[model samples]
Target chain A: MELDGNSSRGKTIASGVIPFVFVIILMLYIFGPGSDLLDLGIPLPEITIEKIDFVDSEIQATVRNTGPISVEVVMADVNDRIQPAAVEPDKSLERFETALVRIPFEWNAGEPYTIGITIDDGTRFEKEIDAAAPALDFSLDLVVFFAIIGTYVGVIPIMIGLLWLPFIKKISRKKYHFFLALTAGLLLFLAIDSIEEAIDVSDENLAGSFNGTLLVVTIVILSFLVLYYAGEKLVKQANSSKITKHVAIALMISIGIGLHNFGEGLAIGASVGLGSIAFSTFLIVGFALHNTTEGIAIAAPMSRGKLMIGKLVAMGLIAGTPAIFGAWLGGFSYSPFSTVIFLSIGAGAIFQVILVLVKWIKEQDTVLSSGAVVSGFATGISIMYLTSILV
Target chain B: MMILVLSVIVGLSVIAILPVMSEAQLKQKTFVTHSGSVIQTTGEIIDPLYTVSSVEFDPEEFLRNFEYGRISVSESGQTIRDYTIIAEDDKIQEISPGVFFNIWSFNGTVPGPTIRATEGDLVRINFINNGSKEHTMHFHGIHPAEMDGVFESVGSGGGQFVYEFEAGPVGVHPYHCHVMPLEEHIVHGLYGVFIVDPKEERPPADEMVMVLNGFDTDFDTENNFYAANTIPFYYQHHPIQINTDELIRIYVVNMVEFDPINNFHLHGNLYKYYPTGTDLIPSFYTDMITLSQTERGIMEFEYKFPGKYLFHAHKVEFSEKGWVGMFLVNDNHEKNNQEIENGT
Candidate 1:
């Protein structure tokens, strides 16, 4: 069923794409990139050679500071030899930051070299790795691996939200106004947040570059225009455009939230890479609460008509699952510039979703008390702001 | 913007022409004096020739530096020093970090070791040919014709010879295997420091030896790794520690081949540079000094502040290619250690 004025076309595409996107994001957030859990203000000495490269007789290793506080690397060894290696910026590395340390030598190809590092705190880390391993270490702990796969728990609530569509449809018109206002509140927060995160990554080409910032802004504006046009086309094709428009706007909201969740995933992943277990735990809880509200936002937009479990599930997955993927990438591989790209596009699309809701709210002439909107917005901000304190 | 563009272009052209001013151009180019003044014409010029006579017409055999399976070190408190060196190929385990370069060194060390002496000392170096090529120890000091290692070839098939000379004028000098294709022999890592103290005795200071050499990693005839003490980024990463307000004496020799010149520039401090190490008096008090190939001298400096300072080649290309290092002067352990830990 192509989207050529077909009734079931949008349903088919939304259901399949939303679930896949949702599951992928959840899985990524849980296991993609992460550090350890620990207490507040406690510094620990830990390091990992996140990547290794041997070229031109120099062995360059990218090391992640998997610790709570700043630590100085006093010495490095290869195969028990007191090899001469130098760390850039004078070797004092902070938590979560990475640095390049290189050693020059004619290496014995095809041989495993164990790179050992000694930090000022007297803690030592040694890992045996080949010279040409890919940047990410995909090795996962058996127990933690199954636990991360369990992030599929996120999909259950999405399924439940889809099933809640029938009862949602029976709500009085005045109650629907509050739900719409609440969804808007949630999305407004996300649009701003997503935009900021997209620009936070450091890179040679993107860091503080006027052109790079312009590129992000351009992508955001273009994303909004593209989604608005496609959404407009979909609404015009159906005889029963009211319900279809609601469903279409709901999917748009989900997609936008998906992008926002990806930014959150990066934050969680970066915290995990830093080996701050307490921070990661707090972040996961905060995001999980945020994700719960997102599911309602996805469903509230579509409660105007009879929404099947399949459609609600599709909407739920579309909106809630991107966080997982964001987390994984943030943990294993994160670049502030790259993260910004996703965030900017998401922000623009989500803004378009808000515009659709605003126009719909005005067209229907529903008496939405400004107090409901103000209270709803206050609740949305307060929930997220309060949850942030747990970390 | 126009000035910036012009300066960039000019900089590029100068760097592009750096390889042109080599020994190969010495015979063809006219000498240009400072400030574009004093242009001298080439008339029916006669090149002057000079020679010095020595005590003996022939040389005597000496002891090998090391016995079988035992390392040999110079005897202390002796005016007459007997030394031995074998020309052989060895690998510097990690020349930079994990980068290794093959070297033809004395005692498996690059730039070898600093051989020190008093001016009146009778120095004898018994040279052994144990490698795959003919080699000789050419000292950049006064010696008789028969003792000059440049003209005499010690065979690789276990050939042995002796070089004996009275250590003349007090100065810092370089010694290397002076065989055919001299640039290759020197660049391939056959070099060391030879320092002779003056008769009046130099001031007591914390002395260190540095041999400035570079590696042709890709062998494109351009140095890829330029360094003092033969390790690229060695000094930059692992800075030499010095006490605040203490004199630092460095006998630095530039044995870098393929490059026409190398220099030493100190950040945050000035040094009394003694060119050729001939006199106790200083020629200039500057933060930087340049040296041609095999040119070496003693430099003295003291840092007043406790900070990590950069010591590098003023030649930007050389410094960029890793001929740079840092010096950390420690006045307080807690303060300096924290700075080092923070990577500042």
Candidate 2:
């Protein structure tokens, strides 16, 4: 069927509108702007303290799943005695919540007192602290969470804005090239920034031989390759189907985005698991914003196809599931090696998708000029910078 | 139709004959003394360390001396008997320090009497907690959350409860203190290594039981609470001797207040550490395996050398506090000459 101007216009507007609205809602949820309704008392999850180590200012307990459905621990307040008090508390305490939980509390060097857990759920769990167990040297979990939050909140919006301008607006070829150059510069900056954050995280490692500088570079390269190949294969396969083509492409893009999101979640989980919640919170907000853009990107291709609402939702989920899984996995298992492997694969897939998109734009030879592309790329970079500053 | 009938017949026949074969093998066992003690305090075995430096203790110098033995309990109290346990580093060493009172145990094994029950049969254990502490038995890896003696149902310090659950899977299962934060109770010697024999009869190699018990003690104190009591305050270290090429099954139980991450390294033998104590996964291989508190790991290895092999806690500090022990593997038919090198 030939493409109709009205339908195409409607699809484009809808694709952009849906994600924009979602982003607004997400922002409200994150920033609690414009209303107290956002903080409506949703019965927060409860944590029960089992034991406390007075020497280390650490509390060992089970976070009971007393809620109807499993909830994620977005934040927690620990005592000052904890050496590195930051912790990423993100995990779904399965229904009827009875899981072994251990958290370190920071205490004054020679102080003796009970430790309590002011969980994200708003309930406090405490125990009479024991004078035994060793003190927690540092929590690596929080470091990862903060790094992820930084990248998501600080790096992703600009990327979305960059993609938007060139593709949506009609611009000159030369200007688009300039925009692309700008984007390349911005990406280099982001990559370097991420590496620096990674190095900072590594410095906090009290256990194991993990060098952040080495790890960040390794993750970036690995992520680049995994995303690149996987995206290429997916796009190639989806391109062949005329009937399911649009949906398939959308799904492919979503999957890649989802994987990336999951990696971000892992970073959050690892940080929280290691007791880095403040940093992880930043990561969550950043990721939540970046993910909204990712949602839009996945929907854009399908919107052009004039697909049904069901298909769009399905595609959205295909992209979203990875984030959910990643968030849970990151919170559950805080293993750096595993996180690195996952992040590498995700980065690789994203790299591949971008390449395919660039190639497709070139082949179309449409009225969309190079200048618009350049402008779009620059916008993406500028937005990221602005968000980073604001954050 | 014929194939279905044949399969059914085979299954039924196998079920009928499996328990008979297991009973026959149980009769072939003899009495022996392991390196550790087998006391009658409460109904459970106290301080049942499988491998010790010496079985012969100087009664004069040592305030207390006891031989390694086993206690078997049936529904009736009259069936109780003292079974001698042999200490062999090559063969599996059997030590039950976690089984608390009133539960009928096999030769004083913690996991009450290894009762061979068929799929349709009910394994009834009328156990009593005669020990100074309250204790309860909870089956591990069993479904039906109620029967899984977790939560607050399992009591401690002379507390008694009956656990009746269907025999689902046939494999080696464990039963221990399901009450309290098990890390501390199990570490204080309140667990037992259990086995649910399969319906199929397998070849019998020289069988030995070795229970790996993690202890947290205060050596400076004089107390009879074997759970937190000091390790045998005899000397610096104790050597456990074994023979070469022996097929050994080590039933490792970690009963410590804290999870004792142990790495059981054999000098020259590669061992298979079973995560769930059954369905051995070869790839989950490691010289140093970390056993969580209240968890059990059963490993099988063949010793190749005929010399003094050191098997101690990977946490090097444990040795200075008496966490180090030795294994002497001698050639076949060669009596351990080093046995006399250190006077008993």
Candidate 3:
């Protein structure tokens, strides 16, 4: 009830002003000139050149900020002449952070060269190489290294899974449909994993301005639509032959699994390039274990077709060769944006393969809600989850 | 019921205002100036309010102070002034908070000491190069070719040279290190203002020197931060205190490199512009003027009201990157001076 109108209005005004004034005073005390009293004396900048290597025609010098303050590499010089250089990851190195500074200059072997780096503060630091020799590029040893990792992680695991094909031939129609459902579940997991990996790469390694997440989403959608339309057209044209339809589905599954394996290889190669992780025997074995399930997904759809040995090897090659190329690209010139784009495509392809398998399963006498199909799907996802823990 | 309803509305409004206020607090931590321009805090941890101590170079002290050197009268009734300037490249100065820059300086400071002399005076500069690199004092006004700092390069490691010339052209000019790769010397802070006053002095008020400059911290041939008198947003937090209705003359020099042009704008007032200060008569009574690299002029204006005013780069990018400042026009100069002297 309204007792005194004027006093109520005055009280309302006072209540409103009280919180507002209190907030203003609190903010001013925290952020205003009063905070200037917290001045720690100025920090001095110190930079050290950690290591220098001559790779091809370029000289890559690893620089570290040893000071309390951050340092930015502003210029690179060769024998006092300013030469354009590229700073990888970033030019600004925070305290204790290291960056790779690559300067392209053609120098003769066994010649003394001075590589100078000018920091943000106008100070030039120089590192002298007494004798310049070309360091290791994409050598035979590195190729062997990538091949061995790819064989363990990509090829051998898929070959081992293909070994199940002989045993799968004796299964009845109902049990075969269950395997198809299991393949779909495995591919669904791979699709989700690829998308997750793409998102992580975009967020961590790429610059924010590149719109990495949006790029991944768009590429995934585009790749999915294109592959779905093509797969449907192929299936419709081969409607007369059940064997052709089965073979076509098996090929699509192999290609989709191939793209996912490529993304895995990229992770392996990039980790080595960034020097954040080592290529230990345990890591290779873990990756090999994680990818063995991918092989079964490819083999499940091919059970109905009369599979020739050559056709099986061709499918295996199509799914396994991309990991090799991914390893080479990621090891040599690993850019996060490219990884995001490729992984997004892999996710889209895998999603489309899952849709095709579902359609094929529906074409059979098996119901989509059958208990066998449901259990098979669960087991498929469970296998991938268990193996991924090793990775 | 009305009081309760009103109180409920007030409570809701406070909830709405809290977020925006806290956002402003976050922006303050990011070094956004009062004029709403973001100073370059990306990849930096600079303290926006940090000013160099008195032992180091003070932009406020460098503003109005002038070096007249040792003065005497010649036998022909002419003025004689002798100045000694030591050029050293080994000095490290904290241009911005947490940002230490290698400054090639004259007498240990960037935009060096303002060398002032009257017109027709025989000005002798005893130059010494104490840097590790070649440096020479090159003045912008009339002088003999032999006395020019170019071609006669002063060697590093304690090189000496004498530049003797009669000071002419009543205006403000820049003197810098005229070494090869000239930009390297200029951008690293090897430059200063040289003021040639007329024999018959004009009515003087409060005069100061402002070097509009920028630093390319990323070595990308583009400036990462812009500033007035070396430190960005300095005058904004600590506004240049001045008396109301007083004539304030500012000698502005643009020493920004890698930038095609830079401009200045004053808020709340207009000034009589003297292009290069070459003429006694005013050129334009305007609030804004564009400057090319090394282009300078004299600005004279009087604030009629007692309040705060902004002076900053008209180019929004430059101001956003740190070239903004403020002027506090007060009626009581003595009390304000006392407060400043007490370091409040």
Candidate 4:
């Protein structure tokens, strides 16, 4: 059944509104001003830093999860600077329930410092403790945080828009081809940038016997090949079935994109985990925008087919899963090689998908001419290039 | 129609009975290794003399000399009265090949042997330090402060201390030397696994003991600067062979002087991991068990089909060097093949 125009229009508005609201709420929760409610003696869940040891520059502590349900912990150093530590939500909070957490840090000897643990449950628990001089040395940079946020919020949306324009707008075929060419250029640039970064990381290592630079390139190329074939097989299989054809196609495309997005998230997560919060933040924002545009790209064909609203929503979610998974994985595992490999794979798969989309457009005999397609492809590439420069 | 019904009934019966037999076959069994022979013992003190270090524990030596050793218990039968462990420095002593130590440990070697205690039993340990430095026993996989042997509780020059803690949960728990010079003391020799069998009941098995220990050393150096039981090593191997489809539960404890997360990989089996000390929950299925320092994990897997498989730490360096072992599965077919080949 075809989607009614009114319902589709309503959904588009809802989608835009929901994300905007969610982002605002997230910001307020993170940076909002608040007063100390504990002074009033209104008993809330208590979190105590039972022990803190600065062993070899890494801050290790045992946090007692004393609340009813699991809570997210936010830790900051003596300077009130937030420390990036991945503390998984505790599912149970029986009294004195403990979780051992470690954060890579460095401290000056004989300097007394304070650490704050903010439990982000409905009832927040804040504990400040004195930290001893560290036995090791490590530092978290702010650039990573910004990078993560920018990737999710900024770059992602623009990329998504570029992905959709060819199919969504009533443009000339030449414009579409231009958009395709533009996308190709942008992707090629990204791939090169990732390889360079991979080399830089390998170069920083001094203790290994193998040539770090060559190994990084080899792995990146291998990852790209593996992801490319995997994506192609997925698309082919999706198209094989008549009964489950559209759904299958949607899923396959989503998986490829998801894998790619996960790599981006890993990059963001790794940066933040290592105390590069600013960089991580920028990455998150860019990836978010890119993913939204990706959703549009996937939805445009389904929209043309005039599928039901529920099916469309389901397809959107499926496509979005990879980005979400990517965000989480990026935050957890901190490995430069892993991040580079995943990003390259994502770039490759997206390149293949765009190719398939162009082919599909060519086979269709519509009033929209080939010139519009070319122009559209070029536009996609140019926009990405302009944005990459800004980033 | 009658023939079809009979065949269906028979098929269903076979399917139903197979798992029960398999479960019976997989029950935990005890195997004792001594001198140069492997014996299946029922109820006697099977290889009593053992070695406990900071990183690993061997119960085979203790099992062999069980009759001579004294297992003192409290009057209530809940606590150990005089559980003595002597730590001393010695030359290369042999209990088995590739297992030699410059350190002669109480219960006899590194990771003093397995101490079997029932549920709710109180274990009192008396540790004698004959080594150059001080040391204390820390029981891992148990509850907080009460049994956690950290801080300056025991030390050198034949000092005696009593550790009283009620044991809860049933599974293989590990105890090690927790004292200053932690790395040197442990590497020299100190650690072993303690098994707390289920209070209710458990199945029987042809049990074999395997412990994975982490040690760090400058392999290039020839001087005995080797802190054997101390730092996390790149590799150490322990091999075992079992019948096809045998149920195996490996109790793994991390006692590295430095906290090193290891990925335990089994070559041909996917292990179902139980996160907590013992009560089995739906496993987080994976080949590698990521173990943190002082953490204990119990992993179970059935070698359903027969084949020789390798299981070891997936940290490539560990497997290539020495932290490696093999699992040989001998099913009916393989046994038959071997017998034919041997002309026996």
DockQ of each: 0.02, 0.01, 0.04, 0.01
lDDT of 1 by residue, A90-109 (tens): 57777767777665545665
RMSD of each: 26.5, 28.0, 23.1, 29.1
Q: Write the per-residue lDDT of candidate 3 for residues A1-391, one digit (tens) a residue.
A: 4669888998999998999999999888877985975457977676766556776666777777877788887656666544445666567889878787766667777677878776767666777766676553678988888877777888888888887887777898777877888888888888999999999988764544456788888999999999999988878777766548877888898888888878877877766654446568888888777777777777887777786678777888788878887887777667676788889999999999999999889988679899778888888888888888887
A1-391 per-residue lDDT for model 2 (tens digits): 3459888998999998999999988887877856665456654444444223333334444345544446443222233111112222324455554443334334443334554443332234444432333423344663454445434542343234324532523444454444433433344333443444445444432112344556666776776776566655665776675545546555655555655556666665555444434454564565455444454455444444553666656555555555445655655555555665565555555555555445544654733355666665566566556545533
Tens-digit lDDT string for candidate 2 (B1-344): 99999999999999999999998765442211221222111111111233223323221121112222234445743223232221111111111121112222222333223333433234545455544444556766555666665653523233445556555464445566654654544544445545544455323433433344433222222111121112332222344445676766655555444433544455555677776555535445556776565565666777766787666556544432234445666795433445555545
Ranking by TM-score: 3, 1, 4, 2
Mind giving the per-residue lDDT tens digits that candidate 3 earns over B177-247?
A: 99989999988888999999988996878899999988776466877568888876677667898888679
Best by DockQ: 3
The fraction of reference A/B contacts recovered in model 2 reads 0.00
State the TM-score for model 4. Answer: 0.34
Better of 1 and 3 by DockQ: 3
User: Comparing 3 and 4 by lDDT, which wins?
Assistant: 3
The best candidate by TM-score is 3
TM-score-wise, the better of 1 and 4 is 1
- The sequence of per-residue lDDT tens digits that candidate 1 reaches over residues B1-344 is 99999999999999878777664454332322212322222211100000111111000000011112222334764367777787786544445433445678775666665677778777877778887889888888888988878788988857899888888779988889889888788887888878888878887776787778887754668665677776655556556778876778888888888889989999998999999898889999998888998888889998889989988898977775557778888885664577789996
- The Cα error of candidate 1 at residue B244, in Å, is 35
Ten-residue stretch with the least lDDT total in model 2 chain A: A80-89
lDDT of 4 by residue, B1-344 (tens): 99999999999999999999887665533332223233222221111111112223333333222211245566776444346677665534432222333553545565466666666766666667776666677876566575577874655667766666666677767677877666665654577767666676544444433455543321221111111122212122222557875667666665544436555788877977776447646368888777665566667777777767876667654443234556777785765677799996
